[model samples]
Target: MDPRVREHAEIIVDHSVDVGPDDEVLLRGHPVAEDLMIAIAELCGERGANLSVRSSSSRVDRAYRKAIDAEDISQSAVSLAGAEATDVAIAVRADANTFETSDIDPEKTSAMARVNKEIQEEIMGKRWVGTQYPAPANAQDAEMSTDAYESFVWGAINKNWAAVREHQAQMVEILDPAEEVRIRSGEETDITMSVAGNPTQNDFAERNLPGGEVFTAPVPDSVEGEVHFDKPLMAQGREVQGVRLRFENGEVVDHSAEKNETVLTAVLNTDPGASRLGELGIGMNRDIDQFTYNMLFDEKMGDTVHMALGRAYEDTVGEANERNDSSMHMDMIVDMSEDSTIEVDGEVVQRDGAFVFEDHFE
Candidate 1:
């Protein structure tokens, strides 16, 4: 019954997916986010949009995955059909337990992702947006109180998206026509990849609420060098930290992790494209100044860069460029707050997290 919850739902309906009259809107979220869902459903009703609600539960999913054999895991025809039929899909995340599926077999997780790739693609092809509802478990993971976490989530979500788009457009201009980009953080991370002919997407809370990144796909065979992602990320219900990857000819040749190495290995072995870079994104949302253990927000924090290891988005790749395809798209972040520079072509654009155009750039 918080005002921000209704505000969040309004953004999802009016700005994110833009549910119109007679549209089929599919809403999926945990029951904990029922208030927000109800707000969204009410808005959909007012707009004359048909609503299909799916209550997702991490516990239920964990039990199912634990009970099923890896080989027996298959895509649900109903799920695919629903995705195909929906005009707008809004997925809200509110985790009751961040590590609910940590005990599940990595191989089985990979298998499930592989089987559901089609469903994912079908949903992605629609007018869709994924946002998170501040939940107690997530707050604990972020090392923040519940009230503070709610404020953080809504502060990042309910904002001037147009201004964000305008601010991020500057980065898009630099990447859209660039031939190559180099990213470096201290001596541990240094990598270069070509972005020629790839379209840079300026994200501003449309597909991803709280979105404030400019992203593009790399040339499939043009990446070379090494990178150490100092930031930790949650993957497969486990925390993966200190990920270091060496790339040669756009494929990861060497990889290691300080934690959850097996999870990283499972992800890398998911498919052929899993070993290659799918996306190169620059975070420009200064409002999200802290790491919250949530990629939805962390990846958009200023002074950060994130790269996904699989499944390049269709819009980021040019028709002439090859799109990296995989069942997984895991984002890992690199801290650029100090001892870092993002070089476009040969010029330094961001030095120690300050873009050259920013007033603070030294």
Candidate 2:
């Protein structure tokens, strides 16, 4: 194992998760992330934490994708129940390839999705963290050296975390100020929303090195107009691009794409909540100026913003507008580098990805 991997392991073990003594820790990832996994286990043991590691792989998943029955796919990962019951659980994404071009049984995938949803509810909002472990595939598709990709991911996480914190504070100040912020993009983007009385919650700030974008749960049924996802999305191991969505009452009334429309439709139709906007986030990490085809990282890149069509996070501004139900959360990015703006309560706060507030972005 590389020494840096060990250093990263320490960060994951100590910083990302404050694993206390006797805490039941569930460490999970695919085989490609094993080095870090082993290091996490070692750290857990040293900390006197009870640790259980679950190593999943793309090859094994391919076997199921090739031969498994749709109805039984959910049952194969039954062991997940134990992990779900643990005190702290971490999912490290280390897939061999981000895009797996195979005839995947949609039904099987759906069943897996359902099971995962059940698991999320089982925890009923427990303390957990999700992160990534860079592999050759993610690096290859990113068109950058692995070292560069690692830095990109790191900077994205670090900067986004900071932005979220800063935005949360700014939101508090803006919420009480007397203003109905009016904002407009340069052209072709007329998106608007009212953040007059929204509560900005602190994202998982005490837990991880999470950074990139700060977000708020928009008022359900309050958004109007259309927006185009300027960047392609990496969905379920495949690249889905050119997504266009039309919203009415903050719900996705109509959507289409030049690519992967079928998959997008299937995901949207997965549940009723899938049709609604869950989160509206702006990427503000200048360090992450390029798209890497990973929503976990890309949505936090500066000059971009994303709208999640389903499942609002617990810590977002808005009322019971919690669109949380679907096992799915999709992040489609819109490049705001040109001809785009975001307003908070009628005041133009961000024009073409730059903050309007003083000392907000420096």
Candidate 3:
């Protein structure tokens, strides 16, 4: 019955997924987000829409962690039952990391992730939107004060939509030339790839409006050399830091990490397609500087770039490149603020954490 829950529900139903009167909507959230979930259902009813709510909590995931033995968790009857039943899906994170820092098997965590990925892939038209209902548990160790973290999260999530037309113009100017951009994090990082002839960066306005990222599927076999990720990455509930991946002919030939090497190995070994890169995106929201351990907003933080290891989005590029596979799309971040440069074709477009077009746009 909290007023904020109704406000947040309106944001999701009216903005994020934009549920229509005829749309069959599915709303999923942890117990902490029950208020918002109920608000969404009520909102759907008011809007003349058919809504189904699938409620879950951190305790459910914890149960799976201790009791589940399968590598694929999505195969469970409950998950399979919800796969294609709705036109849109909303996942609200509420204290998901309740036990993240505790003692848990890495293998079990990865297995749970694989299940979620399977559900996402099978329900391709679901038009998923992920966000968070902040909980104290998530901010326990954050470097920034809780107030500051909330500000950062709010600014990052609403950055694109709040400014709308202006944000679109800025994106066009940054990606205008449509050329290959050479990037380096240091001698250890030498990654060069082409973004030429790809779709011009456009707003998801009226569709996936909360989305701040303007991404493209990378050239399947164009990625070459090795690069070390500058930010710590969390996957399948396990944290991986100081990752260095060596690429040969666009496939991950070798990879090592200072933390969670076994989990990384498991991801790379998921399938042949898992070894190849799929997405190459640069974060543009200047308001988001620090990491919050959430990929939805983290991958869109300014002066940073992330690459997904599997499953390129079909709408991102041409159909000639058929490398998209794997149930996973693990996004890992790299900082471009220090001792790094991005050369578009032969022209340098960014250096030392600044963009050449910053003055021209925004």
Q: Write the per-residue lDDT of candidate 2 for residues 1-362, one digit (tens) a residue.
A: 76666766666667667898979888878898888788788899999999888887777777767786665555434665684668888778878876562567666766676767767665445656777777787788788898888776655554334346665566445543322323344443456554444554434334434454556666666767777786898775667888877778767788888888888888889788788777777665577778776666687677777788788776564453443455567888888777666666555666666676746433
The root-mean-square deviation over C-alpha atoms between each candidate and the true structure, in angstroms, is 2.3, 3.6, 4.0
Rank order by TM-score, top first? 1, 2, 3
**TM-score, cand. 3 vs. native:** 0.80
Candidate 3 lDDT (Cα, 0 to 1): 0.71
TM-score of each: 0.91, 0.82, 0.80
**Residue runs of model 1 more than 4 Å from their true location after superposition:** 63-77, 105-116
Indicate the worst ten consecutive residues by lDDT in candidate 2.
175-184
Candidate 3 lDDT, tens digit per residue, 1-362? 75655666777777777888888777777776666678878888999988777777667657767776664445565675677666878777767456642555766666666667767675665776777765555554345565666556555554436565465455556564566767798768888776655554553423442455567766777788888997888876689999999887788888999999999998898887798888887776666678887776677777887889998877676655454677678999989888887776776667776767566421
Clashes of each: 0, 12, 0
By TM-score, is 1 or 3 better?
1
lDDT values for all models: 0.92, 0.68, 0.71
Residue-level lDDT tens digits of model 1 in 230-337: 999988777899999999999999999999999999989989999999999999888898998888899999899999999999999999889999867999999999
Sorted on lDDT, best first, the list reads 1, 3, 2
